[model samples]
Target: LTVSVVVAAKRENITHHQHANVGDLSSAHGFHTTTSTSYYVTFLVESGDRIELCVSGTEYGMLVEGDTGRLTFQGTRYLSFERI
Candidate 1:
């Protein structure tokens, strides 16, 4: 899937940095994406910085199955972000 993390000093700002696409979910955890599929974005910011999560693509396939190899196409998804 494709995602972006935009940060700016004001709400009117639209500047952003495009990151690479994330790969498939991990086999160990059917609901979680691979650990290596994370993005590390670094930029200058102040105390009142504004960050946004923007998505513009399909996160799953047409016929995704469950861990048991059954036809289960509905589940939960998550995203994680950490400041260094």
Candidate 2:
């Protein structure tokens, strides 16, 4: 599916997790950290409706706010955006 829309906004969400291990007196202690990131884009359609969709890092990088384009998708999945 495709729709004509204007790029409204973009956002990124990141989450971090930390793990710690404690050993006996003969051993050592250590800490490990992990992070996860997600990207999303918001579009304004001709009907004046705004829709937010989760996108990949590459897709997010290619989109710019206030850009007008054609958004191609399958259901809630994001495919690509072609600037008009």
Best by TM-score: 2
Going through the candidates in order, what is the number of backbone clashes in each? 0, 0
- Cα lDDT of all candidates, in order? 0.26, 0.89
Q: Write the per-residue lDDT of candidate 2 for residues 1-84, one digit (tens) a residue.
A: 899999999999999987675554433576668899999999998999888999989989989999999989887788889999
Candidate 1 local Cα displacement, residue 55, angstroms: 9.9
lDDT (10s digit) by residue, model 1, range 17-82: 433444534434234223323222221224333223321123221211221111111122224322
lDDT value for model 2: 0.89
Weakest 10 consecutive residues, lDDT, candidate 2?
21-30
The TM-scores, one per candidate, come to 0.14, 0.83
**Root-mean-square deviation (CA) per prediction:** 19.8, 3.4
List candidate 1 stretches off by more than 4 Å.
1-35, 46-84
Candidate 2's C-alpha runs over 4 A off are 21-28
Tell me the deviation in Å of residue 31 in model 1.
19
